[model samples]
Target: MSDAVAAPVLTIDGPSGSGKGTISRAVAAHLGWHYLDSGALYRAVGVAAGWNDIDLADPAALVRCTFDTRVGFRDAPGGEPRVLINDVDATDELRTETAGAAASAIAAIPEVRAALKERQRAFRQAPGLVADGRDMGTVIFPDARWKVFLTASAEERAERRYKQLMDKGVSVTLAGLLREILARDARDANRPVAPLRPAEDAVRIDTTGMGIDDVVARVLALIDG
Candidate 1:
């Protein structure tokens, strides 16, 4: 493939609260490249399914949801990612924990994955893309020139999530968050399709107690290498 057509992609895959979202956004902004929050795409899809009263358990419903869904990202270059569904700004609603659970639930549907696969790939256009999600490196952008799998201890991740929600004035328990994180991890790891896993060639980083800049620096160093 020509260099222009073969746009470089940096795939950062990890579970929730692993700092993938923050690090990927920073990297994309630093490089002046396009940013793809693949998780947000699924979250938006889940929100759309809920709005249409579609059953996420129904495989056919999942297929239709993916086909009929319209997700857009505003200010994806260097600002807070805002998601729009069907031309309507659903950013706030899609950021809720409820929406995230729905995303985790629907992401396991094979039909839904197939439907949105090309949509994710389409983001690999001119310039480049920093794609972040559970399976970005393994499934969404297997040919990405740089691949990093970020992770953190479950307890640490839970604490991080708790702090974020508390900062937003959302009442939540760290213990509850920990339980939910473990459950989601099990689900993601055991999902039949596109299960959460680092690609064989991926470099894994444990951000247990590291600050965002430290982790970002490590990833940037990897990119430089």
Candidate 2:
């Protein structure tokens, strides 16, 4: 961030099911700052492209999806983030495993990343911004004043995901979730573009057993001090 003009940004980067989304939202709300759910942007692009039957292999098609897609976030204090694509409520669909896989895949394309780079950065407005994603701190907001890398053991993350799905009445096995998570971990960590790793200046928070409030408080302290 350039000292002359850039607004403040607090980046929270992590893998799926790591509570990055939840924690970042809470912190943003608590601070009255705008929040960015960067993963949802990729997922929205993938889903919108799928709706139009755009070939995923064609980088041009994917690039067009980024421009044609309209994503909106409707979030309130003490509420879950709601995602809308093309003026339609896509919050539930965006949370599906299929959408996540698509996001992870399209995220590898250099064109796609280039397209969304400024889109993500535009979230930096007003008082501050709490941006959450796999590469927010490492790539999107490298100069953010506060950076947090939230993570958990694979087993623990899988368990957390299992409960969340079960609560939604979606039947899923724990073993399957764990296997999928590990697979995605390997994929994200080894992806050619923007691999999933913490920025050297980031504070790593292992959230394996800690509650949401505790993690939020820890991150808040980073900027508060």
Candidate 3:
């Protein structure tokens, strides 16, 4: 395989709780393509910085940390994929609300985004790639053959997140989760660097009332067409 050739990519961009992650994984699996969870990269960075007691507000420091960090993703024995930071399994650590908030804060830094750009793009391989992120279609894979923007109402998203957390035995209030979701949405959509907006050529899917299978089927039809 020639290293110079860019692999075709299917970009799935959306905010949190939009089912983009699950849908992207399904699409990648169906097409036998590599998958890139770009948000997990940021979350891993945030987790690593927290482990080292680094301040997120320091853009220069965060950028340096991003380059110095080594993030890996691999399937766990009986669960979802695991995230590794410097060989340490931080899969669970990176999913905390704290880490997510920290990630959002640092992702606003242009330097941090630039540092992770190539790393995220490297997942594209011979077969193809399915990239899921807030800006995958808008920035990371603008030339992607397929671009989708998934979304859901804030209330629905909050309920989904609350249920997810509760299932894992995490103590969190639905109202609080809703507030945080709204706050994160505001920050993500208003950020100056690659704000969370659908690409012009991207298809928008509101997953508020759709099941996973339904969403997947719709996306597959688009790809087939």
Query: Could you estimate the TM-score for every candidate?
Result: 0.95, 0.95, 0.96
Top lDDT model = 2
Report the C-alpha lDDT of model 3 over 1-225, residue by residue, as the tens digit. 554246788899888888898899888888888889999999988988888888898888888889889998887654557889999998887888998898899989999999999898788787888899999998888888889999999999989889988998999999999999999999999999999999999999999989999999989899899
Candidate 3: residue 192 Cα off by (Å): 0.7
**Candidate with maximal TM-score:** 3
lDDT of 2 at 162: 94
State the lDDT at 98 in candidate 1. Answer: 88
lDDT of 2 at 72: 92
lDDT-sorted candidate list, best first: 2, 1, 3
lDDT of each: 0.90, 0.90, 0.89
Better of 2 and 3 by lDDT: 2
Candidate 3 lDDT trough over 10 residues, lowest sum: 1-10
lDDT of 2 by residue, 127-170 (tens): 88999999999899888898999999999999999999899998
Tell me the deviation in Å of residue 191 in model 2.
Answer: 0.9
lDDT of 1 by residue, 29-107 (tens): 7788888899998998899989999887998987888888889877744457778899999988887788989999999
Clashing pairs in 3: none
Q: Which stretches of candidate 1 lie over 4 Å from their true place?
A: 2-5, 76-79
Q: For model 2, what is the error of residue 149's alpha carbon versus the real structure, in angstroms, after optimal superposition? A: 0.5
